[model samples]
Target: MNRLTIYTLFSLFLFTNCNENAAEKSLFSASKSPNTAQNIILLIGDGMGISQITAGMYASDSILNLERFKSIGLQKTDAANHLVTDSAAGATAFATGKKTNNGVVGMDAQLKSAKNIIEYVKEKGLAAGLVATSQIAHATPAAFFAHHPKRAKMENIAAQLLTTDVDLLIGGGQNHFEARKDNRNISKELAQKGYQVNSFMTKSLDKIEPNYKDNFLYFTAASLPLSVEQGRDYLPLATSFSIDFLKKHNSNGFFLMVESSQIDWGGHNNNSDYIIQEMLDFDKVIGRALDFAEADGNTLVIVTSDHETGGYSINYGSSRKKFKTGFTTDYHTAQMVPVFAYGPNEESFMGIYDNTDIFKKMMETFGIEK
Candidate 1:
């Protein structure tokens, strides 16, 4: 063949291949699924950083449920006024899509009441829930339903919880409901509001058959609950059971926020055993959640942390099933945390973003307009 003929043919070959590649890429992008999740399961492991997860994996000597997630991203967990965020501000960011000042919950930095995911869904006639190892009125879970300038005001948060229209609440802080100084029995009030309020004193969670017809309220403890080592094993079961009950509670589906609240407690204590056991417990809850998500096929499960706590680290001489752990502080550090997503719309959680983006993403996944 002539040189000009050969050059022209080579150029055409390269151009055709490039066009085909671009077309394939466009097709793949167009083929991505839209918002399709009927149910959303958001799991927040408070104070659960990468090191905490690593320590759990090593100590448990098994794969974590988190390892199964294919879509993982990091979140910037900074408060509006501070680099290191408290649970209130961190969780507020996730609940309301706003970076509030530390100590704020369910409110923006301006101290204005913010509409949280639970409230947003509840108004849409969907079931909303809060499950935490800490008091339900504590910093993390309260952010979903209670707006307050100060998160430490548990009684105020407890009062606001009653107004939230949440379908289910499983955690501690029963006393905050009934033992208030205001002389109002919030538990009785909740019952008057047509809630089925029960407690650990009445019966254990496993034996209780949830009647899905009513708003379920089961307080696992009077105050802060025990660690898993001390027989606090209700998280996975409560999570599993709540999924079933909420699925029945609302035909429109549910938005359940499950918080492994004590992993952060362990970090605050700078106790390795506490951190390890809580991390493992949270992992089991993650497994249970994934189990439901896998079987149901329409549930989206997102696992993440509000912030990294204790500056936790796995140090030299660590071995499988045993860890030489180190901590730099007994409080949350300025560290971005990982977000693991599965099921429908999981692709939306693939890149690093602000903590507020989590709220936006969940809203989008629910197909919420604006």
Candidate 2:
């Protein structure tokens, strides 16, 4: 009775404990799986590489809102035809989940027009908005709403913007819309489309309270907006305002793309101070987005860059208070960029992937098929 009974009881005890542990593991995994987000806020810092973020962190006394993000990933920034990606292709990858040739916007390498995330969200009854420090018709922001083959076609891009169902548009480039060669005023056309079109020539953004009932468009400049160092202080404010306005405008949810567009320009100019200033400004915008996501609990905030510009690097002898920076070129380089994500489905973004995966991940996070 001793050996046989003891062996049988020990085997039974081991089987029961293993079954209980398996059940607990399954429950934990389900709880941590990606949950759908009500709102998705994508903040793109153009040409914001690791060096740019490091410089900004050092310049800002070693504190960055990016550090608050726990899920981070690296994205390969290559266009369909080139190793070094331009903003148009880079942004198109994020907006459309397609690898297009360099200089293409909202289209693939075969010149096929792709539906972007903004249009997809709008079709699903979610409001869409774009905020940028550059012209609204610029490559990055335009990719979200326009389908132009060439990024240089600002006039065409502006025209396409008038056709989209985007709820809010805040940036520069009023001339591309109103002062067109066709002698047509797109602002009036936007007004006809039920948008409250205002410009820097008429009213400042800080003074006017946006009405959520009507779509809003505020051109910050006639052409390209000024740099942050040139007293362009509206990025953070625009970010905060756009989030609130889009939230109020749409009952289901909203998709907003905010771009700190000038950081790439700084890299192109090989200006270290320019990069640092723009980087710091973009960090503030990220902080505002994080604050909203933290409070809303149903919002997903994804921060990343299209590609790395200027081949930027933080050199040796850099201190926590100062950054010794260097640049390899004046244009964008073939390098992978970093992606930081927070809120719902943030875990999906924590790995190495293609740039187009951003659009896929965001769409998945919103529970949108395809």
Candidate 3:
């Protein structure tokens, strides 16, 4: 063959091979890249241990919203100062990635404040919201936005809510804000700060449509809210409403923390029926969150508990429709809680880890450092 013809053929062969390899590399890249979610919905079922979940599933005819999750992990629940962690400290570990003392909210062992994931996300221009069945100033909810040495300081926690950038607030504790020892009308102050504040006494959640142009707040009760069995029925609806409100409030993205707060109360009371009822209610809310995430395809839904309560267990003679349960204690226990995640980057939550890793994984999902 001629020298020019030989060179041309070799160059052509090289180009064809390069093009084939590039196509293969492109396919590999698509499969390997993390499917990061645009929005995150974190659902905290306080004191919901494995037994609690099991009981709920049985009571629901062997079905639960949690069964939808494929990515599951176990989280070690221990406080900085105790083997058994309180909701405040366990939630603080998840919020700030720091293991604080029991009964402390958003503060470390030394009473120093730690910046929570919500604050970090808000600083990045993402909207944040909090919803719970308990008082808004309760330990689990308060840990995300308030810093206090003691979680019992509901009045102080109520004051801190007025200073937060949270776009939506739904729960109880109206009395803490309106009839405080300091006589500070926090609800009025919230309205003055450009929030559209409403209450169960003034307007039901269905009556008040959320407007993203202004912040929203809905007080469910004067103190603690009623249990699901006692006529409280807004949790599932509120979950759906908050997701819509937050998405509209921020075009970039949003972070929402929803709590089925009374599950712990049921555990504290050692009432199996109460736990099952609360669990079923929380499951409905989970279904609502999963519905939004599955449809959007850009939302991550994480469900977990701070710790186990009551050392609860299913006893003998339990059927698929009924649970014969027993409890070892009436307070919190040093038990590993289950974590179930779905949607983009859900795989990151798999496997056992510390409670604080929940915070780390969430930050990594958002491409945030420290």
lDDT of 3 by residue, 260-300 (tens): 99889999999998999999999999999999887776678
Model 2 misplacement above 4 A: 1-34
Error of 3 at 9 (Å): 31
| Tens digits of lDDT, candidate 1, 1-370 | 9999999999999888677763354344334644557789999999999999988888886788889999999999999999999999999999999999999999999999998988788777789888999999999999999999998899888988668888999999988888888978888888888788889999998888777888999999998888897988999999988898898888788999999998998899998889889999999999999988877666789999999999999889988877788999999999989999998889889998999999999998887765
lDDT of 2 by residue, 254-356 (tens): 9999999999999999998999999999999999999988767778999999998898888888887576778899999988899999988999999899999
The TM-score of candidate 2 is 0.90
Every candidate's lDDT? 0.89, 0.90, 0.90
- Spell out the clash pairs found in candidate 2: none
lDDT of 3 at 73: 97
Superposed on all Cα atoms, model 3 deviates from the true structure by an RMSD in Å of 6.3
RMSD of every prediction: 9.9, 8.8, 6.3
Q: Indicate the worst ten consecutive residues by lDDT in candidate 1.
A: 22-31
Clashes of each: 0, 0, 0
Each prediction's TM-score versus the true structure = 0.90, 0.90, 0.91
lDDT of 3: 0.90
lDDT of 3 at 286: 94
Q: Which stretches of candidate 1 lie over 4 Å from their true place?
A: 1-33
Clashes of 1: 0
